[model samples]
Target: MENRGAKPENVEIGLGKESFGVTNLQDHNIHTEPELGLDIMRHSAAHLLAAAVLELWPDAKFGIGPTIRDGFYYDFDLSFSLTPDLLEQIEKKMKELQKQRLPYEQSEVPIDEAIALMEEAGQSYKTELLHDLKTKGTTAVVKGLDDPNVFKTGMETVTLYRLGNFVDLCRGPHMEHSAQTGFFKLTSVSGAYWRGDEKNKQLQRIYGTSFETKADLKEYLARKEEAKKRDHRCLGEELKIFTFSEEIGAGLPLWLPNGTIIRHELEKLAMEEERKDGYQRVATPHLTKADLYYRSGHLPYYREDMYEPINIEGQEYFLKPMNCPHHHHIYSAEPRSYRDLPVRLAEYGTVYRFEQSGSLNGILRTRGFVQNDAHIYCTEDQAKDEFLRVMQLHERFYRLFGIKNFYMRLSLPDMDRLNKFVDDSESWTKALKIIKAAMEESGLPYVEAAGEAAFYGPKVDFQIESVMGTEYTMSTNQLDFLAAKRFNLEYVGSDGQKHPVYVIHRAPLGSHERFIAFLLEHYAGKMPVWLAPEQVSIIPIAERNYEYAKKIHDLLFSADVPTAFGGVRVQVNHSNESMQKRIRAATMKKIPYMLVVGDREQESGSVSVRTRSGVDLKSMPVEAFLERITKELKTRQDLPVE
Candidate 1:
């Protein structure tokens, strides 16, 4: 250990530093590579930020600062509030320190001594963490929401990284010096609860991002600005699609009339597709007896996400978190044979969950949402084919929506975390093999992750990126070997013996709420002709054109002959507002078409069409316009009206 000057008790003024030599760096592989080093640099930037904050406000206390998806955030329990001005000041201080090229000196101290050092410095949170590490091991500290990799179990000493005058408890693979953190910009600040619990103190979190090059940082900032403009919460309100009320509660979205229309179009498409795929739609009650969940193993494994049970008629009922249990009961209601195997049960089921308020984001993460869910109970022999069929169905839908940048993530269980999954190792192995075979047979790109599987089995989550490059899990498909045994779902085999059926749970569209949110951002609220709530809006140039506009509206409305895409919703704007104002209103609503009727148009029996994209499809006969739009609707293509 190199003693820079400070004593061991305080570990300040850069003293008693442990050696992180070339051998240790090689063994641990501290990130010094290209793109792989971005996270390490960002994490080091977080420490630099903390050191700057302490320089400005010596009394400030900080919690853990971790690297999130594209950035890093540090939480501070400060006596004063942080603002944009303060962020700039902190950035200036960080630059001053960076110019010095201060080395990230390392030190290791006994757990008790570390606690004493934190206590002397008045960092109660750090003290608490050190005590937790000493008493319950690193696993227990991880359960308290700290990073699991930050400490090792049964270790008597903890590593601390010192950046100048500031010291932090961390098991680090950070950049060598402050200058190596690359170009960074402080983005924003928000309030966050310590350990993600609402009961804990609310700490002000400062968010920022780092990039390897100035051009990369500039490009990221540009994309971030575009993302802000395309934020779903803002667009949802501007489009009048959805709203939330305090009385209705958080994460429970209230869809407006226009939003309902959009949902109807999506549901119509789903029904048509499922019908062609030979799926039998089933409906189940929103509430079910708690015993059913226990039998399905959801009560024990997913209790935290589920709502509390409701007692009625001396029986406990739970708002169903999923429809699999109900569908199982339906399958067992009638006896089945091998010939009757491979029952595909589909449902647009509305399920309820008690999502944490902090995690809720617009309609994306909601308490009440309807899933485009289905279950295929098939024999082992037919399992691969059925799974491939589901994958094909997903591909078909994605192709229709022009969603090309999506991939599957195979989530497998970690034996170390066996408590989170079922104890049936044999079943787990078989299910994993089946899913792997089906995925490989599809010849699609996929990545595997450990400890992310479902409680009963392994699953493939379809991760999709929006136009702004933000990725999320849009759909999921799981192969379950335990559900059959748990629910006693069986089919008689060719040998006249009852055999447990293999179950595949899939949700291609995920939920209307989340999918709609994605669509709002993906399309920038300019929905395609087929999915637009008001497909056409007729605006009269003057009062004389009113009659002609009404005639055009009626014609288009009636021409919406019952099809799977449903009716082409058309409206006639007869309000006293100016024609341009009406046109602007329709444009703001993202209506696919604006048909302008004037004396010349009326006399010629034509309508002047203007698209939401500012394309003027000059005068055309009403019949010709309808024919063109009808074809677009039928095809369900995002053919922007030109």
Candidate 2:
């Protein structure tokens, strides 16, 4: 048992290391304390749920029950489809079990005895799990690892959690007893394939939320409701930002005109920032030879996520999955001295990955997207300064976007998994020191995650909070000391000898698709004026003033206030609809400016300017209106909105 509060103390009980048991709980130390001991409470509630399900369906084979952000879920193999009424019954049963004050008893059972107990209880899944563990060293060639609970590791003993009449295969540091699980709700039930493989049998997955107190749960539920209202998928379509087509493909989005405008503006802004920081822009092909990836050491580590190779001219080519390899080739394509030591290359490069269909979420997760990718090559001494600069750049980005809630995560390597990476002890130590010094120098609040680093290097992942209070990774900065040697890229040092350059890989905006999706939800479709699809919507009071509206549109369009989609995002609503209706339409579209031209204003060579927030700025001269908009666009200021 652990302390029951937010940010728990020593909740994780590690069995051992250097040949650790491969259960999900084994790694829970990294994620043990989450928001007021909620993880422990939710985790305990999962056991309560399992106990409840087993009571109703005696033969139900239970699967893993992991605690999620707001709640937890447990998969069960049952005889019938689940319904809401049955969920209520399960919740009711769980409440009854809680009244019994059951204690979760952890026991170490011998492997053979564990298998015999599961087999006798008709838990075929558990038996298969142990059987796989016993044959883990035999290379039995599993058709597919289709069970999330199945860890094919031959542990000396199986740790089981017993709660009343129900026994589950679990590595538990659960609550002391059932009272800790009092405030919980069984949220929903859905069918999920075992282990997320479509070919595997579908199991009923029950989802629920648990908090230490009812007030906390209520606040969380309210946030959940708000999240639904601000979901990017809904906001995107309603605001004409982006849409999907089944005929086009899954995990691939065809950016709508409005969405294209936002992306173009973002690219333009990022380019300007990078240019100011001495970054040279370059473009690379969408496809490259597979040999390049093999040389870059990406094939062995990332081949599963990469698209299959394309056969061209009897050579295997692949869709470029990452930009670093190509950038490294660029660095090696020329000869240089220490003067070019701090070479920075940037691009809005498009990359492809074969994301599983189920894992894809609108624009947030897609197969094809463009990244604000950059690579910096500098001397070993300049590496820390460059890393600090990257961190400063990240802070600049967040400030510009009004993102106040975020922290950096320093991802370090796991010594136990050294074989999976390029294991140069000296290089790893040097790189870790450089990054750690930079982090300390930068004086930024950060957290550390072990075993989260890339195969090539450690990295800093920028986790930004969405408007809904959800923290998500918005950017990543990595320190790579091996890519230079791997690509044979070298620059002559001041000592007049060839030296391996330090590589710093960064993506401040992450990707065009995901960032735009985030902005949509973050601003609630009230995009900043510079990045809004349509900066101004011209609405005439009646048909008689349509000509004046057209003239105003022409003038603004002619000014061409730096918009995406290759043109000014100005529209003249010449329809016969009432001016109020047209204004309403423009407001709903999240247009930053609505210029309503009527007879008197048209004759006065002026127009009534109304902001998207419904503030009427009365009538102003056409020149002054244009200047106001031009200044807003130039400064890229976020205007106040409704």
Candidate 3:
């Protein structure tokens, strides 16, 4: 750890669930290798930031300062408004503190003393936190606090971290002194509700990131700049993929023709794959009786995410938050026998959730989204096989999307919270064993996470890393022994007895909205031929070539190319624009291929083609070019360029 330079933000101590504790780096064997090391430095930098902010504003009320994928943010309620100038000033203060070599001294003080000190410092938030700690009986293992996950351990303690004159109530595994945090910059600031509740006062959140070396920070910023250029929200507008309107309502995306075409293609691909896997297509109503959710045990556990019930006549109903409950009802709708034991049902179900407004991020986090959801009801003996099949489906989707960096996060139930989890000891043990065995056999890299599982069963969440190394938890599958038991879904086994069936819930693509966003960033909006809204844009070099361009467009429209909006997306630039300008416009739209027609090409019965990357393919006969692209589009080839 010293070789990596200085102390880690926190140490992983033993907890019934996932937890970390603050301690000197020398106390335990800490591995700050690469990614983990970067995270530690960034989190530690957050402490440095709070310290800096404290110097600027003596009345600043501190909030959580957790590290995100690429940066960290700390919320502070201050007397004066924050500005770009203020951020630069804070950075200077941080640098001064860094030079002072203030050790991140961790101490455990009596709850009374801690509260008094916080009150004296005029930090109501810290005082309130201390009061909560007192009520919760601050009995942590009494060590350094570092990781943000440490807070969730539910331990009440006053771990005071003092650096120079600025002190904060935190879990310290910060740096031995401030300088070890390395190079850091204050990126930006935004209004964040204290504790993330809208009703709470809005606190200004200062965001920043840190790296061990200036070069590393430069490289990270370059990738970040690249990511901004490929951001789906921007590309979506430029390519006319999707749009939003205040009149249409928030988070409800209005898909244009191009976006609709791409969506249908993705849906077509998933449908065909599931069909080959013997999944029967099924559809459920957008709304369902509230009793159905109660029966499936979603009413209490999932109530917060779900919208308040709609009063349909005298009974209350709900827009479905998930498709599994409806599928469970479907399973119980008919009498099942052993021969029909392993029934696979699939749907491209659209579900709704009352997501917090601040948490929404383009299509990635939306109020309404479509899920590639499916459920399988099978005997206990068949559970592993079905789960493995689901994993394979997930792998296939990742391959199709050209996502190579990914692993499974096996979310296991927290044993201590039996009430939150199903209280079936035998079932829990058997289900977990089955999931683990299947994962081990799959030969995929995976890690187990305690307390991340659905209340019903353990889940396998697929975490995908984009080309830029940003990770997203985009897909998942979970075994459901509890839902089956709750819904009383059973099958007539060969033993001539009605036995409760095991259920497997799987979503390979997650949601079209979110998946498309991932694809946009993954491909940088240059989707492959199959997924591109406009597969080809036909451009006429002059007015003489218009007739030939239309003919080529007709040929494509007649072929297997997708049709949306009106007819096929065989865009013909009929406007009197320069050839270069037209070509550039087509390239900007990210059309997979552009067909350039001129007098010579028309006379030769050929078309010159250029890929979205502007590489010329010279001239080829119209038939030959059609054959090449149609085959590529139909097969959904993972192309080298877009």
Poorly placed runs, candidate 3 (over 4 Å): 1-181, 189-207, 416-423, 561-568, 638-642
Per-candidate Cα lDDT values, in order, are: 0.80, 0.79, 0.77
Task: For residues 1-642, write the lDDT of model 2, one tens digit per residue.
Answer: 111111111111111232112211222433334765667888989999999999999989976688876689999999998999999999999999999899999999987888899999998777776776666622134554565545556665778889988898776779988877958888889998776668988999999988777897788778778778788899989988878899999988888888887888999989888888889999999999988887775575557657999999999999988888888888888997899879999999998877789778888888888989999999898999999988888888888898988788776667666554344757877888999999999888898887655545667777777766755566767788777776887999778889999999898888888788788878888898888888889988878898998888888887857555444568998787888998999999989899998999889999999988889888899999888888778778754433
Q: Cα-based RMSD of the predictions, in order?
A: 10.0, 7.2, 8.0
Cα deviation at 107, candidate 1, in Å, is: 7.2
By TM-score rank, best first, the candidates go 1, 2, 3
lDDT of 3 by residue, 1-642 (tens): 111111111111111222111112222221223477777778778989998988887767887788876678899998888999999999999999899888888898876888889899888877877776676443233442553444534344467888777787776566688888899989899999766568989999999989888998898788878988988899888888889999988888999987888888888888889998999999999999988777765565557667988998999999988888788778889999989969999999988887787667778777889988888999999999888888888888888777898788786666776454345757877888999988988888898776555445666767777786666667767787876667789999899899999988888887888888878888999888778787788989989888999999898787765333333457788788888988888888888788999998999999998987888988999988887876676667844542
Residue by residue across 1-97, what tens digits does model 1's lDDT show? 0001010110000000111111112111112223558889999999999999999999999898988767799999999889999999999999989
What residue pairs clash in candidate 1, if any at all? none
Q: Which pairs in model 3 have colliding backbones?
A: 22-144, 22-145, 138-156, 145-171, 145-172
Error of 1 at 222 (Å): 1.7
**Which of the numbered candidates is closest to the native, going by highest lDDT?**
1
Error of 1 at 288 (Å): 1.6
Count of steric clashes across candidates, in order? 0, 3, 5
Each model's TM-score? 0.80, 0.77, 0.77
